[model samples]
Target chain A: MRKRLRNDILLIGGVLLIAAAFALIFFLTRKEGAYAAVMKNGTEIARYALSAEGEYPITDGETVTNLLVIRGGKAEIAEATCPDQICVNHRAVSKAGETIVCLPQEVVIKIVAETKNAPDMVV
Target chain B: MRNKKTKKLAFLGLCTAVTLILAYVEALLPPLWAAVPGIKMGLPNIMLLFLLYRFSVKEAAAVSLVRLFAVALLFGNIMTLAYSFAGAVLSLAVMNLLKRIDRFSMVAVSIMGGIFHNLGQVLVAILVLETAEIGYYMIVLTVTGTIAGILIGLAGYLVLKYLKQKEI
Candidate 1:
């Protein structure tokens, strides 16, 4: 029984260590986003530079409206017509790979780096 | 023999009910991390771990599936069902595999189940949302899942100890 307890602790410790390492790598490798890509129904509808501060309204037909605001090198959904309002409540994102998804509106706002080596297909 | 089979069935049914109730209670609680959609304390997993240890893998899997469908039918939509179904299946698979290997303790199996559960959900999110960008959330999810796993695993450990004492 004592051996079992020891084994459990060791296993949990190892997993926590691995998770911490991944988190550290994630934080260190996170880069400032250069563009906010507005995607509707899985397709990139528009791209706005994070360097430029502006507000863009993304609409899907007549039913949905998501107001995306870029300011201070960060992007956020300022207003959303969706009932949940989860997207509007999301915090501003400035790091590449951050995303604000309005599932109701099928709108996805993702941050991406403007890299010369930007892959044609990012998997 | 008939009486024993009836008892087994009754136990499985009771386990399923317990798991569903735990899921419902967790759902009622407000989001721990507003940024993440699927983050939860995974209270139901404690029950699942208990079932896994106290019963057969087949019984555990059956109860888990029933719980998933029941929860989805009562409180979730199609998307929720998709994410949860994927998570539950993957988590069970991992736990069962670990149990078969028989090297790690039950707590270790539970933790691995929790981590894989989140990974399974993330995979579904990537597919359903049609964006690979969601993969970035894996780091946060993994960390949270590990914590939740530890809590659930500890609870399962205590319960297992008590059950052993009672010879249940």
Candidate 2:
């Protein structure tokens, strides 16, 4: 039992160490994103600049599925028709690689790095 | 031989039923952390671990596949099925590999299982969303997975201890 306990402790410590390292590296490399890209059903539907402050309704056909709010350099889901409301309850995200995903709505809001030369508007 | 076959079938059926019930219970409960999407207690995995130890990798895998299809068809969406299928298969692969090594305990195997499960789900999320940025969640999910792994491992360890005398 003692050896088993030691092995378990060692395993837990090692795994946690790796996870901490991953988090540190992620934080060190993370930067503020320029665009809040929205995807519906796994395809890019729209992109909103994080620098801009506005409310954008992410519609699927005629019905709005999610209401996205960008303010103070952070993006968040303000309203969603999804049953879980996990995305709506999420904290606003501003860092690159941050996301607010509504699985039920199949809508994803991701903070992404700005392209060197951007197109006028894809959506 | 026929009697042995009957016993195996009965045991596997029992495991599948238990896994399905656990899946239902897990679904009824809310997410552990609302901010961290798809973080589950993975209560069903306790049975998986039991099967792996008491029987073999084959039994565990069979039960896991059945549970995935059953849960997806009964209450979940196709996307959910894809994510879970990926997670379960990947997690089982790593767990089986580690078990074959014979160095780590069940607790260790289960921790790795939890981690790989998240890895699989993250991969699917990336593919589905077509964005690498969703990998950000992997950081948080790893931490949550570790905690959940410890819980399931401890629970499984206790069960194994109790059943050791009877060899059930």
Candidate 3:
């Protein structure tokens, strides 16, 4: 019992430290400006931008779902065929703290900022 | 003596197969929450932690090597394999070294492995990209590593318990 208590304390301390670290990252890290989309099946499926709007299609071979468009820098699963429909519930992602995951479709859309002096940018 | 040696070799082979399967399984899982391009859940580490305790260090190393190569071939992502392999090797070394300390539990060791694993991978990315700023993801990586390590450690603990009772 005493050993378990010690372990619990350690875990809690670890969690606190991680929280602090995330807080630091939240403040210290700057959002990269350029935006890019992760397309599926040659369609403009998911968009990552500060502000924009357009039609997108979600295709799974034979079937296709028309996803509603969100104009701006936010990613969301506007439509899907999966039974869960959890993807639609995902709010539009903006501010680098966002992610829209479609598990059944194996699609992950995210936004990332490129670092300054990024070799690609440097050259 | 020769027969015993053969049995040991077979056992090592089996462990290698199990590790390979686990790693490949993780690759198949949907990257739903992968907001960043390279982030992953790495569920296979669960099997790794289990092997570290159930089998010998040499056996675990064998498993890691075979798993790395097999996954690389199967996924056809040579760059990712290269980075992941570097991380896994470094993490395994750290775990083995920490295993020598009596006070460290398997779970703690696994957490250390997770932290080092991400650190090593991030370092590889930085080097490959020729950009030091990629290191800014260190905090995020550490957070994810801690969570993943703990989850895998829990799985290891459960499996170990079941094995102890079943005598498997």
Candidate 4:
């Protein structure tokens, strides 16, 4: 019984150590993003600067209305016509690599860090 | 003989029903923090863990699969079903491994199950979303899954303790 108890603690401790490591990495790498790039069907449709606060209604012309609200340097889906509304309920994201995905609508709001030094912001 | 077989089958059905109800309750709940997408308490897993300890892996898997399909059909779509099925299969496999090893406690097994379940779902999410960035959510999810796993393990442990002395 004692041996089993020790094994359990060791296993839990090991898993927590890994989780903590990832958490540390996330914390360190987290950066305020500059753009909220909206992608539809794996291709970029719209790009909004996080510095500019506005409500952008992203739609595929008719269906899939996801209101991308950029406020206070963070982006959130204020309203969504999707059934699950997982995107709407999600908290606003500001981190450079953060994303909010509405699978049903095939809309992905990705936070891209646009820096003058790094050259990836040609879009 | 036949009586014992009937008893096992009936118990399986009961287990499946209880898990299905718990799944419904979970489905009704909004996301835990409304921040993380898949951060679930995994309440239905309490029964799955109970069955894993009380009976065998086969029994637990049977109940889990039944509960998954029933819940999906009732409250979810093809997407939800896909991720859930992935989570359930991965969780059951890990839990069964821990049980076979017999070194870890129910809590440990339960925690591993929760971790693997989220891992599986994240994998499926990465595939469907076609992005590796979503893997970052697993960091937050790892902590949430541990808490949920501990709760489930405690509940399952209590149920197992009392049920151990009783006729199921």
Candidate 5:
């Protein structure tokens, strides 16, 4: 009986830990930067902002998906290229220290708060 | 009876192939609503668990190596391969060692493997990124890995149980 109780406790604890982690990710952060396009090889490929009230189209010489979503006071690609479309399913990102990357297409959408630049002190 | 060894080798190859296909399939799943990104299903893991119970440890390790390399090559990520390779080797070693404990259930062993795998990957991530910030992600990963471990373990347990009952 003791062992069973211990196991139950452990399982409950594990579930709570996971829930807390997700909550921390969702709530504790403040809004950061405006939407910015991630340019590579001099091409506009990705855009990110404080919220996803706008639309951003992304392409990779083949397929294109117009990603739409809002996160952390910005708007960016909630989806993108290729048949799998897994990237499109990754909804909007809206928090500090959060990132979304499209490896196959070499596109990264990120948010940066304006106040983040205050760390100018030399290391 | 004429080619038992050859038959065994063929079975191993099939296991490895199935695992590779599953790995890619899971990789293609869209991430759910989370700040962090990851693949779903962990389908290849089902094969690994099957081999662990049905075959010897050496055979399971062999299948894992082939599947890992094949998936890495198809995915075209050498860096990602290194992290996964480290995790696979370490997790396999831990699980194999723990399997020797008479009282340890396969479920427990699988859970340990899952935990160690996350630890190995997080260690690699810390090394590759040259930052300690990634360590924070380990807590989240541990919870995820443990849940996945339990589900996969139960699947393996049921399969082994069925095989034993059928005497196959």
Candidate 6:
């Protein structure tokens, strides 16, 4: 019984350690993105450099509308016509690979670095 | 022997019903993390762990699949179904493997299952969204998954202990 308990403790400790390592690696290697890509229906409709601050309106004719704001190296959805308002509520994202998705309108705003060596796979 | 088979089938159905009810209750609750889309308490996983421990893997798999479909039909859309189906299958497979290893306790198994569940959903999200950036969400999801897994594992441990005491 003592052995079993010890094993359980070891297992839990190992998991925690692994989680901490991964978190540390993620934060340490995090890159600030240079561009924000506005995608609608799985296609990029517009791209803006995060170096400049601006507010852009994203619309798919009369069907969907979202207001995107980029400032201080961060990008966010300031307003959205989607019912859930999830994208608007999401925190501004400046790091590479961050994304704000408005599911109702199929709008996806993603941060991307200008580097040509961006990993194609993240497994 | 026939009677015993019938009883086992009935018990499996009961487990499935219980799982579905738990999933429904979880869905009714407000989002635990507003920023993430699929975060939840994973209440139904407690039932899955219990079923896996007490019964055969096939029986547990049956209950898990049925509960997924039932909940999706009642309260979720296609996207929810897809994400959940992937997570459930991956978690169950990992738990079953861990159980077979016989080295880890139920709590450890459940925690691993929870982490894999999040990993599976993130994989599906990446595919559906056509972007690798979704992988970044895995960090937050893994942390939340671990917490939820611990809760579910503790609940399962308590219930299993009670059942053993009752000789059920």
Error of 6 at B103 (Å): 0.9
Quote the positional error of residue B117 for candidate 1 in Å.
0.5
Per-residue CA lDDT of model 1 for B70-144, tens digit only, reads 887897777778888999999999998888877788778888899899989889877877898877677777778
Q: What is the Cα-based lDDT of residue A79 in candidate 1?
A: 93
DockQ metric for all predictions: 0.45, 0.60, 0.08, 0.66, 0.11, 0.41
Best by lDDT: 4
Instruction: Score chain B of each candidate by TM-score.
Output: 0.94, 0.95, 0.87, 0.96, 0.89, 0.94
Error in Å for residue A43 of model 2? 4.5
Model 5 segments more than 4 A misplaced: A1-123, B165-168
The predicted structure with the larger lDDT, 2 or 4, is 4
lDDT of 4 by residue, A1-123 (tens): 898889998998898899899888878988889888888777777888888898888877876488999999999999998888889998899888899988878788999887654333223
Compared with the true structure, what per-residue lDDT tens digits does model 6 show for residues A11-88? 767877777887788788778888888877667778888877988888778544899898998998998886667788
User: How high is the CA lDDT of each candidate model?
Assistant: 0.82, 0.85, 0.63, 0.86, 0.62, 0.81
Error of 2 at B12 (Å): 1.8
Every model's TM-score? 0.86, 0.91, 0.63, 0.92, 0.63, 0.85
Candidate order (TM-score): 4, 2, 1, 6, 3, 5
**Candidate 5 local lDDT, A75-113, one digit each (tens):** 556666545453465555554544444444545555445
- Tens-digit lDDT string for candidate 3 (A1-123): 467547645854685487577677776774643443443422334444445455456556667643545556555667888654556766565545334545445454445464443232110
Candidate 6, residue A86: the lDDT equals 78
Error of 2 at B82 (Å): 0.8
Score candidate 2 by DockQ.
Answer: 0.60
DockQ of 1: 0.45
List, in order, the clash count of every candidate structure. Answer: 0, 0, 5, 0, 16, 0
State, as a TM-score between 0 and 1, how close model 1 is to the true structure: 0.86
Clashing pairs in 6: none
Docking class of 6: acceptable
